[model samples]
Target: MANQYDRNPFAEEEEVNPFANNNTGSVPAASNSRLSPLPPEPVGFDYGRTVDIPLDSDRSASQNLKKKEKELQAKEADLRRREQYVAFATYLGLVLCLFWNIIAITTAWIKGEGVTIWLLALIYFIAGVPGGYVLWYRPLYRAFRTDSALSFGWFFMFYMLHIAFCVFAAVAPPVVFKGKSLAGILPAVDVLSGNTLVGIFYFIGFGLFCLESVVSIWVIQQVYMYFRGSGKQNELRREAARGALRAAV
Candidate 1:
């Protein structure tokens, strides 16, 4: 019974140690001693240590300038071409009008047709209105400003004036022939008497056409000036481009 109790006593008490859970304590300390030293922190960057870039400031500037010059030259060339085209077209139109006038005069002379003359005079007046604005004023104004040439304000003003002139012309014949006969079934006497008023219209229209012609001459001179100026600008641009190219090289 004593032996059995002693055996049981030995089985009842198992040793409980809290320090057994910390088996790596001395091993961690010994391993830390064997570890390599940590790397040092990097100092602040040295900005001035960079290599010098071989940037040719003059060469780059010249290249950019040459590109700009070429663009300007191209634009000027296009403008010159457009100007030549416009000039040629204007001259062609003038020739056509001249031919038209000749034909109208010839027909009127051959037939002694007063109506033809009246019609021609009316056409002359219509043409002269625009011609006056275009030939006399527009070119000189464009020469100074260069921007007003494409503006429609002047054209619009001329159109309004033309309409007013037409209204006046329409009313004048009736006023002139107010008391005339209505005979010949087509207002013949009125139509015939209208010619008397139209005779005055012819004088006015002829004077305007002459003025317009003078203006056209002046406009042509302005166009010539533009051409000359454009040529000089082109030469200067070419020279500038050559200088830029040489500098780049």
Candidate 2:
């Protein structure tokens, strides 16, 4: 029974330990042996190492250029082969003309008439073979080879005349100009009643002439269409302008 005023109510009470003085079995402290060594400083990355990468620009460019060159060569070869058909057609027409004239000469000789016409035909044959190549075929060939619009224009002019010649030679109208027409369809039809053999020869000649005419017509149409469709007309104008400028200069 202590006096109430002598007790301080805010003071903490002291805790008592029952085993403070007991030393027969003691607890051990926590050990660091089982804890893992902070995982070995995470091995620093080798940022200083450098790697080289190769980019062969020149090799790539050379390969690309070679590929383009091959393509161009193939295209040019195809163009050459394609354009040569027209030349071949021209040669064929000339050969047919040669044979047709020969037949005409033989027929005239057999008939013992039309000597003047056969002489004229002989002269044409002598000139036309080489002349055909030089005049029309050569120009067209040069136009194809060099892409020359002037050459194309020359070919057109000469080839048109050639086509007209073929038509007249094929039809063989009466010689209003000079002599009886070349041995052609009309002449063959006229001679058929008299000499069957001569008429047959004339018809053969007429057939050759007609073949030549047809070939000439087809070639001219094809070439003219190609000229128009392939924009060569524009090129022709440009070339003309260039020539005029050069002449003026």
Candidate 3:
């Protein structure tokens, strides 16, 4: 019998392919035309490159400004101390002069020495120079230098008042005495007895001294307040900037 399935000579047993229909190939030799060496690796863009720029100038400027501020603060403190010391010294000097006047007046009264009284009055008049320098000139100088509210007008007005009072003291007795040593003695005694006119003069002088002292103390307080306020504000600003820098870091 002739078999239905026959090994055809042309087929030669249909040589089997191990990878038949698997879509597996030699990958077309990785065509140089299509691959093109990966486009030279894209030049390796870096996001963390450090840039060099000189910040020393800016840093130096900031440091210099801080130093200048510190220097100014130190100077202000020194000036305030000096002003207070001078004020205390002047107060002491004025008190001493007051004592000297009191002694001279008592001696003149007890001894009834007219020449001595006149000499004492002259000494009081001369004492005005030191008093005026302390109460008027020095204070005004400090006020101007410190840009204080204690104005030259305040000094001038008080100084004029002092001068007017002194003039009254000098002339009042002569006018009231009327060329009699006994009359001079009576007027002097009236002053010691607390006559209304003499009392008023004393009150005005005391008021002027009190006003000067008050103004000086007020100015010192104002300077201290300003410095403290500025320091607090600067500290707050510096702390805020530091917080921002820390966050970035």
Candidate 4:
């Protein structure tokens, strides 16, 4: 209502933008982000770099592990083959010993002088052969196949007992340990003057027992040395301790 150019000293002054373009509209903060492009990344920045760094050491270590695994497999295979050969020899010996013992016992029965020995031999054959296989030989085989320390321990224990039995048989003592021997050296000598055929059978039986004892001793030595070298004793102790703990639990 006042004059158009007149100034009101009590009124607030409006700000003037020296460089503002009249054609452009005011932008809001939220809309500014959408309107503007992101700043360009530095020339050699690691923004686009992959997360995983390729390392030669990691690749080489993996290769080495695979190589060791292969070598171990090859060694185990060779050991298995050697064990097979030994097992074959052992089987042959067992069969021969049993066969010879049978022949000796049969000869004793026919002669009638060593029928008591024949009875003992019959029991021994029935129990010993199968017991040897189940108690010792199979355990030995399993130990080799599985690399089981426990199985090896069982084999050693039973095989030692078998060796002792072999020694007793070779001695051929009469009336000792339920007549363990078929026709020991004593009977062979006693009957030699009277019956040549029976004496020969008895002597041969004694000799075979001696041979078996020697072979058993040798085989045990070989197996034991290998077992020790393989460092299975520590593993055996660990397994035993674990078993005890489990039992307690």
Candidate 5:
């Protein structure tokens, strides 16, 4: 009873399997990834190394995409700069018009015939200079600084008012008497024979102002389009994701 498994020295051994080191094809492999020994190569088998197909097309496509990205960045920078300059120029033109109005008012005041013109110009200048500094110029500057259109509200309002202003200035016919802008609207009219010089100045201002209003409307629309476009949104999202990934790493 105690001699069990002790009498096999003289007995024949069991048959060995050729694939015992590996599992049978029908059976599942081990959980680990180490491979078992493979069979020897058959006679006349080529055993040639794998032919590597060069990815020249893919590399070229990537290079082209990178070049296009650089071009796009350059274009955006140029556009932002140009837009800022245009905005500044428009504001300068508006300020010049304000100055012109003040000069006209002063000339009328000197002639003692344009009390209305003088008072209105003075009031507008007093209110407008500070108001424009706060609402118009500051907002516009902030928008361009960050490449944003969030400040278009003030710009739109300003330009709309300017459009009406152009028409208002045009209709008030400067009937110059003794070198004055003796002009008025309904319920309050200043009737006087016009001097040729005042007529020329008023007409020129009217034309310039009308053209400026049209241009300002167009510029604000362009700014709105740039702000709402999906291109910038997607680009910003991608940049954010990249930043997050970098932080994680």
Candidate 6:
């Protein structure tokens, strides 16, 4: 029993087994095989929305300018629409004045009753006919086409010119034919003296002339409100437009 306990088990190894190929030092192929190329990381991701790329400063500014231009064009279109209506009324008034003057002059000449009144009426016609074209038609045409506003100076001058002509037209018949009130065939005297037929004519015709002046003042105000109520940049633009127009004129 003592000798059995002291003996080495199987005398260390039962003869070398040459057929065994088990080598603990060799590693398996799994570690070296290309690690299933890791799932590619995503590029740019949004929550189902397209991303906005950064824009160059100049390009952004140019787009903004185009947007402003479209808006300005729209505003100008609205202004021109109203302005055209006023111009139409002004033109109508001028035509009426021309016809009224011709009729009044002819009536006075036939009767030979109001020489001074006829001559004054002729002068009034001259002022209103051509002056209307120059002051109202051309300026308004340019304003509408150019998308520009008449400055206060231009409008004031025009308004005053009309007032001067209309006041004389209304007041001159009495001044010319003072102390003779019976059968005054001149349209102005007839109107002031309450002649039904002539008074109605003057009311419609000369009333329109006065109306045109009033509306012109209003139109100028509207235009100023539109063009002048903006920033410094737009103010400079309007000023430049005024200069260019003056040169053209």
What are the Cα lDDT values of the candidates?
0.46, 0.76, 0.52, 0.77, 0.60, 0.58
Off by over 4 Å in 4: 1-76, 177-181, 242-249
Candidate 3, residue 86: Cα displacement in angstroms equals: 1.2
Model 6 CA lDDT for position 137: 65
Write candidate 4's Cα lDDT for 31-60 as tens digits: 454566789975787778788767988999
lDDT of 5 by residue, 1-249 (tens): 668767777899888888676646778876989888999976865578676767998899999999999999888778777766776666666666666666655654555545766777666566656765676667767866765434555565675675565455545544433223322231022322344444444445555556656666666666656655625446545666887999999
TM for every model, in the order presented, reads 0.36, 0.64, 0.34, 0.64, 0.57, 0.49
| TM-score: model 6 vs. ground truth | 0.49
Predicted candidate 2 versus true structure: per-residue lDDT over 98-210, tens digit per residue: 66767766676668665666667777787778878888888888888887888899998988887787778778887742323466788788777878887887787777777
Per-residue CA lDDT of model 1 for 113-231, tens digit only, reads 44544454456546764674575345434443453432323433443443344334323343323311111112223333545433333333334334434444444454556645645
Positional deviation of 60 in candidate 6, in angstroms? Answer: 11
Q: How close is candidate 4 to the true structure, as a TM-score?
A: 0.64
State the lDDT of candidate 3 residue by residue for 1-249, as single tens digits.
Answer: 868796666865667888766554845443455644555556656877887868998899999999999999898778757755654554454454344444444454454545655455555546765666676657556654654444443554554555454334433345523311211223444554545444333344444444444544554454446445445436545666887999999
Give the candidates in order of lDDT, highest first: 4, 2, 5, 6, 3, 1
Better of 1 and 6 by lDDT: 6
**In candidate 2, residue 93 scores what lDDT?**
69
Candidate 2 has what TM-score?
Answer: 0.64
Which clashing pairs does model 1 show?
A: none
lDDT of 5 at 24: 68
Clashes of each: 0, 0, 0, 1, 0, 0
lDDT of 4 at 50: 82
Name the best candidate (by lDDT).
4
| Local lDDT at 196 for model 6 | 48
Evaluate model 3: give its lDDT. Answer: 0.52
Q: Which scores higher on lDDT, 2 or 5?
A: 2
Off by over 4 Å in 2: 1-76, 176-181, 241-249
